[model samples]
Target chain A: MGINSVTTMSPGVGAKLRRMHPLPIRIMHWVNAVAMFIMIGSGWKIYNDEVIFGWLHFPEFLTIGKWAQHGLQWHFLGMWIIFFNGLAYLTYGFATGRFRRMLLPIAWRDVVATIKDSLRLKLSHDDETKYNAVQKLLYIGVLLAGVMIVLSGMAIWKPVQFSELYFLFGDFQTARLIHFFCMAAIVGFVIVHIALAILVPKTLVAMVAGGPIVSDADQSGARHMNETGNHP
Target chain B: MSKPPSRSIFRPSGKIDSSILQADPKLLYEIDRRKVIRGAVSLGALSFLTGCNVSEVDQVQSALRAVSTWNDLAQSVIFRPNHLAPTYPESRVVKPPRFNAHYNIEDVQPVDVNGWKLELSGLIADKRPWRASDIYALPEQEMIIKHICIEGWDYIGQWSGVNLKTFLERIGADLSAKYVAFKCADDYTESLDMASALHPQTMLATKYAKELMADPFGFPLRLRTATKIGFKNAKWITALEVTNNRPQTYYEKEGFNWFSGM
Candidate 1:
């Protein structure tokens, strides 16, 4: 029952997992994912209604829900979920030292070394015991991006209500662009993260079945898991 | 897939083989300031994928415009004909009402009401010009309602004026008209759906806080509706046209959503 501890279990070797992600983290992760999905879809549909580019908008196919109102409704409802969930996640991160555990105290040398080792296929640092330098940077970067996205979203949603946030982004329109940019960036992370999950089966399994699994993540998976979000 | 470079004269890169600027007037100006015009590039790549040339500006423009218009139509369809925007009490009114305009407040011209006239046209049966006194003489009603602004501000203020719904009924305007366009003396123009014009809270506001609104506020008269954002509360009114034609609003022309609902 050493799930918290990574283990290599083969068939007939009963795998009693101790740790990977606790139930709360798993639940929050999926909740966050669902909320993000709703937000992106509704966000795109609402964007279509406004036609910001002065040209082509997101084709209807990429958007979520049926109509602009439907999108608007879902987008707004999802906003509260995202806000509260984000708050909970952030509070947990800071309160449990997971925020610090996930991010900092890395030397510049370590970052350069990580890059060199990654490219050289030498940074097989995905032990799941802790995050590597690159993983830390990406996690922190994405977290900050999430915060900005929410703030900018609020700015756009109620510019008059939250004039400071609106003005901080320069205006309603600029805040909108900032929100869209952050959304796209997070989506990009989602794609890379999913692909990494494919490469490192244990990382995926660790999240799902809990882990007492093999630690020999395929080298590419190791780099990807280390580089993406060593979500523990 | 291999592709050809665009040879459009107005393209940002000076590459004109295929591009999006041909369709949108703002694209060229937008790209000049933004180092990376994300939409154009993404569309250009998408055009390449679909084997489309950027030269089809008219079709692309029409398609995008169609979507915008469709959004308007959808909103119109969903608009509750009988629904009214919520009203607030005296205490909710924000003091020193926020002043907002496209241009700075200092530049607002004090329109001379002595000879000022409210021009009327389009579907209305009466086309005679109206005066400030004529507006003041109308049956007065007061409602302290939240004025929502698209710029993201809100305030409650008691606006007293002739109820626009009653005025329209009295004027014998074609109530079935599609849009009620307001042309401001300051050159800003905006429009509202007929349904919105008939909403119970819709008023031709003459006074703010129990006194005639100063010129900086929409003097003589301005639209005061409970539901719409601030931009819809156009000021310095000089003309009104009720018509089926989808006239372009000043902000709408500048890329704001036409049916910008709450």
Candidate 2:
């Protein structure tokens, strides 16, 4: 029933039970994923109705809504979900120090090394719990893009009520352009994220089922442990 | 000559004839082909993967509609009565503002400005009709504001008319009423919340760019509010009503947000 009893009975089972992705983090991740999918698909449909560029248009198959009006409805629905869900994710990340632990301390040397290894197809995924410099950078960039998309969306949605936001983005039309570019950034991030996850399938498994529970001490000594192949 | 009945593209009441499908197999095949393609790629596949049926799709639609209604309420709550939409300089105003209507431009039936009367009704102390001259004689206010369309395009225009609040006050409208509805000569209907109707920048615009409104535009009068989307500014004004009951507007019935405040 207790942790000590479980550890005494089966140490491997006990360690595996402690997850890399905590329950809240997993839930938030999946929820945010669904919300983002809805927002992007419906947004593309809305964009297609009155395209900013004369030539560019999202194909019908890639879009969500049946028509422009239906797209607007789906967009508003997704907007509320993303707004509240994103707020919750941010609060959870900051409150629990998850962001600090997982994404911080990205040195220039680490980034350069990671890029070099990545280009050579030699970047290690031995420690599922640790994020490389490139991953951290991408995550941080996407987070900022998420924030901008919401703000720019609000500016476009209620330009008069949020006149300050409208002015911040230059104007209604400019705000739309900002929102569109933010979406593009997010979409680009998603493509790379998915491609990397597929390349290292264990990372995807770690996110879904949580690969392993690495303690703070183990995480600190992960590199030394990987080199030594130590069980304990 | 008797005038033909006006057909609303928004509210299509007639059922499609099945005979047409039988008569043209090619057309039917085309329809089926598109449906199959859509099903293979879009939400249809999603619904199938999730084991969701038509009723579940309806449930999702209803849920989204509920959120939209809540959004309307939320927007009204956040709407500042005194916050003015940013005004542009004269140079920014788009000359001959882009024309938009449910129908094509050639089909526009220009209202007879000489015979046009602003009819009033519903919860107003004054239910009298006034000629176009009466509205033109009233004290006027001008605004150079952006006209944002629901479809994501926007343009700047100069509009001048009696402030809607001033007009409603003059007509003795019940200020506490829930909605101020409009009926256009073109048979397009629109409504505004009482708060939006009373907003300082809302007006029954009579002129554009210091000139009398062109026939292609609303010839005699049109609703012009800085806060709401362009479609909410119904053109070719014919009647105004203040009422507690919500009036369904043209696009609102077609699933556009009713309180499309921007």
Candidate No. with top DockQ = 2
Could you tell me how far off, in angstroms, the CA of residue A137 lies in candidate 2 after the best superposition?
0.6
Scoring only the A-chain of each prediction against the true A-chain gives TM-scores of: 0.78, 0.86
Candidate 1 chain A: 10-residue stretch with minimal lDDT: A219-228
Q: Which CAPRI level is candidate 2?
A: medium
TM-score of chain B of each: 0.76, 0.78
Best TM-score among the predictions, by candidate number: 2
True contacts kept of each: 0.00, 0.90
The number of the candidate with the highest lDDT is 2
Model 2 has a DockQ score of: 0.69
Error at A88, model 2, angstroms: 0.8
Model 1 residue A150 CA deviation (Å) reads 12
Task: Indicate the TM-score of model 1.
Answer: 0.51
lDDT of 2 by residue, A27-51 (tens): 8889989999989999999999899
